[model samples]
Structures are given as C-alpha cells and as structure tokens.
Target: MWRWILERLDEQFPAFDVDRWWGIDDPFERMIGSVLVQNTTWSNAAKALAGLRERSWLTPQALGSLSADDLIPAIRSAGFQQAKSRTILRLVHWLMQHGGVGGIIERQATTEQLRSELLSLKGIGEETADTILAYSFNRPTISGDAYARRLYQRVSGESLRYKQIRHAILDEIKTWADLARLHGLIVEHGKVICRKRSPRCEGCQLRPRCLFFDHAKRLS
Candidate 1:
C-alpha cells in the first residue's frame, strides 16, 4: 500500500526537493533550520534562519563560537527561543566535535547511531532526530509527524505510534531517495487532501485505497 501510494503520489504531485523547498542548500544550514523549526511554523522558522544567514552564522564553526543567549535574538520568532537556542548550540558543538556530517559518514556510522546521538541532545526529540537523519544525512527513514500519522491511519486503517510508523515505513523503503520522496509526498497529501478535518475524499486519487474514504462511503 505504501509503495503504491508513493508511486501514485510521485506521478501526481510535484517532487519535494528539500534544498529547493527550504532554499537552504547547505547541509549545515539545513540542520540548524531543523532546530529553529521546532514548535513553530516553517515561515517563522524561515525568518529565524534568514536572520542567522544574514549574520553568516549558519555554519557549525560560526555558530559554535557563539553562546546560546546570542542566538535568541535571531531566532526569537520561533517560539521557545531559550530552549531552541540551547539546543542549536549543543547541536553545533556536537557536530563540530564529530567532525561534521561528512566526517561521520566517513566513519560509516549507521543511521540508528546518529539518531540516538541526536535524541540525546536537549531539544532533539524523535521527529527532530529522524528529520535530521533523513533530510540532512539522507537516511532512509521518515519523521512520524502528525501529517504522516493521520495520512497513514486514514489510508491503512491502523493507528500506529510515532516510532512505529517510522519503522514500518523504513521496512518498505529500499533507499533514502524513496524514503524522502514518500515523506514529501505524504506531507503534500496530508495538507491538500487527506487533511485532519473534512478531507476531500472525492477528489483524492487514493480514495479507492483509503480506509477512511471507504468508511465515509458506507456512512453516506
């Protein structure tokens, strides 16, 4: 079901290129944006990121030199300024110590190891960790965010937990590119069609396969 859904989505929806979508092509900047985006909308996070970019603080070395307090002003738009500042500080320091993502790749580290490392930090939760892993490191895993949960539940007739959904998708994904595409497509689907309330089941191309649509049909 997941694989078919991915193929159909790829054919129907515009491809989600993270670098193009975020407009932050630098891997390090992408990682920092991940932190800024926590508990905030992407536009607010983009504002924080743009502020940092204007200050040329997106690099690990540049950001690592500053204290968490210094980041609050630039990232104030993204709520939880204090916590996010500290989290970004810790992440930068940790990344620098590990010799950057390139170095970590040279070490042939597994995705699980990197995920565990990220989760150990102050503000890095499962979703954030998996996001960094998938988007930044190009790992074959998806963030089990609300969009994913709702979309999957509606389609599969199964309500899985965050970690459960992630692992289940990983099992079906053979490569990072496919995983990224699947996640990107899922986000689009959730936002435009299979929304949390009043989903446009009639317009959704996947209506035939979606359990929620089937149920809705019975009720109607």
Candidate 2:
C-alpha cells in the first residue's frame, strides 16, 4: 500500500524534492522551519524563514541574542508569532547550551536519544521531533504530519496515534531516503488528491485501495 501510494505520488509530482519542500538547506534552518510550519501553511513558514535568513538571524547565535519581541516581526506571517518566537528562542538557548548546532549534529547519541532530548524541550512535539530526526539528522524515521495521518487513516481504515503510525511505517520502510520520499509524497498527495474538503476521489490513482473511497462507493 505504501509503495503504491509513493509510486502514484512520483507520477503526480515528478520533480518533488523533500528538502525543497520547506525551502531550507541547512539542518538548523530545517529545524526552525519545522517549528514555524506548525499550524500554518508552508508558504507562510517559508516567508518567515526567508525573513530570518535575510537578516542573517537564521543562526543559533543570532536567534539567541534577540528577545521574543524582536523576533516576532520576522515570523509574524507564520501565525502565533508570540508563541513561536518563544519556542524559537528557547530552542536556540538550548542549542547554545548544548554546544550549538554542530555539537548536536556531531553528538554520538542514537536517533532515539536525540529524539528524547528534543521532546523534552518546550515546543517540540512528536511530529516536530521526528521531522528533525529525519530531515535534520538524516535518520530513518517517519515524520507523520496531518496529511500523512489522514491519508493513512483513510487507506487503512484505522485511526491510530501519530507514534503508532510512525512505528508502523518504519517497520515496513527502513531506509532514510524512502522514509523521506514517502513523507513528501504523502503530504503532496493529501494536498492534491485526498484533500480534506471535496477530495478528488473519482480518478485518484489510489481509489482502488482507498478504504474511504471503497466504502463511499458501496454506500452509493
């Protein structure tokens, strides 16, 4: 099922690049964009990231030096500016105290260990932590977003927790590249086909295997 979905997405978005999805190259920038993307669209988050980059404030030292008030304007487009600014500030402080971005990247800790540490921080939830683990650290982990969650639930006819879904995907797909590509594909599929409202189900490639579509057809 996962492979089928990925293949369909590949056909749909031939030029998809997981790294380009967030418009960030550096691991730290990716982590920051992950946080900024919470409860917001990627375009808005990208704007905020661009703002930070333009000011040369995308670094740990620059973010750590600024107060939340000073940071709010740059990230206002991402929504919940005050809260996100606080989260970013806290993350920067934590990173600085722990030996900056390089220190964390160079640490000999396992992915699980790093994930645990990230989860212990203020605004870092399971999804965000998993994203950092996957994109930032190049770990073989699923960063299950809302798009993936909804798509999986409809496809499997099971409503599982985020961690449960992540574990299930990891069990089936273990390579970092596959996991990353699957994440990007799932997100793109959600946006393009299995949308939340008025989903384009009639000609969707996955309609044959989609539990929701099958059930709807049966009911009709």
Candidate 3:
C-alpha cells in the first residue's frame, strides 16, 4: 500500500526531480535544512539557507565557529532562532567530530546504530535523525515526519505509530535514492493536495486508494 501511494504520488507530481530537491544532494545543506525546518515552512527555511550561504556559513567548519547569538539574525526567518542556532552549532560540531557526514556513513554502516547516537544529540529528534540518515548520509531509512504520517493515515484509514510507519516504508524502499524520493514525493503531496486543512482531494490521484476519502464519501 505504501508503494502504491508512492507510485501514485510520483505520477501526481511529475516534476519531482530528486537532483533538485533544494540542497538535499549536498549533505551539509541538508543538515542545515533539517534543523532550520523544524517547525517552519521550507520557503522560510530556504531564506535562512540563503542567509547562511551569503556569509559562507554553509560549511560545517564555518557554521560551527559561530555562537548561537551570531547565528540568530541569519536564521530568524525560520523562526525559533535561539534554539535552532544552538542546534545547528551542536550539529555542525558533531559532524566535525565524526569527520563529516561521509565519514559517519562509512564508519557506522548500520542505520539503527547510528540513529541511536544521533537521537542522543540535543536537537536531533527521531524524524530529524532519520532525515539526516536518509538524505544527508544517504541511508535507506524513513523520516516518518508529519507529512509522512498524514499521508499514511489518509491512505490506510488509521494512524500507525511512528515506528510502525517508518518500518513499513523502510520495507517498501530498497535504496537511499528511493528513500529520498519517497520523502520528497510525500512532502510535495502534503503541500499540494493532502494539506492540513481543506485538502484538494477532488483532483488527487490517490483519492481512489485513500481510505479517508472513502470514509468521507460515505459520510456525505
């Protein structure tokens, strides 16, 4: 069913070019974005990214050198400036300690093992850790974010726990690229159709397979 949804999403949003999903192809930028987009829109996060890039603070070294106060103004667009700045600092320092994203990927080898360590970090929650693992480090793990949970709930008729949903998607996805693509497609679906309020279900390709739609139709 997850694969069914992914395939439909791929069809619905035909312009999902994995190579151009913001700066996801770049590990450093993705890490920054993962932090910046904690509870904000990607557009706002992009503004923060642009601010950081303008000052050459995109790199772990450059960003790590700055104090939280130094970063607050630059990432204010993303909101939660105080906390996110500290998080970015911790994340960059951690990355540097681990010899960067590539080094962690090569050294860890197992997503679960590395995920545990990442979860221990100050700002890295389950979703953020999974996102970094899947996109930054190029591992085949599900992010299990709000978008993912919402999509799964609408399609399957009920909400599974985060672990269940992540495991289900992980089972369906085989490669890191597919994992990234699945995240991208689901996020696009969330923003464009499966919105938090007043979802545009009439034109959604997945409506036929969506249990929520079926339930709504019955109620109507």
User: Which residue pairs collide, candidate 2?
Assistant: none
Taking the tens digit of each residue's C-alpha lDDT, what string does model 3 give over 24-88?
Answer: 46878988998898998888999999999999989988988889999999999999999999988
**Off by more than 4 A, model 2:** none
Residues 1-220, candidate 2: write the lDDT tens digits.
Answer: 6767778778777899987775667989988998999998888999999999999999998899899999999999999999999988888887888797788878888889888988898888988889888888788888766888899888879887788788878878879898998898888778888899988888587887889999989999
Candidate 2 — what's its lDDT?
0.86
Q: Can you list the residue pairs that collide in candidate 1?
A: none
Over 4 Å off, model 1: 14-16
Error of 2 at 11 (Å): 3.7
* lDDT score at residue 122, model 3, on the 0-100 scale: 90
Tens-digit lDDT track for model 1 on 83-186? 99999999988898889878766767788888888999989999888878878888777888898889888889999999888878877876988887788788
Ranking by lDDT: 3, 2, 1
Question: If candidate 1 were superposed on the true structure by all CA atoms, what would the RMSD be?
Answer: 1.4
Candidate 3 stretches greater than 4 Å from native: none
Clashes of each: 0, 0, 0
Error of 1 at 120 (Å): 1.0
Model 1 compared with the native: what TM-score? 0.95
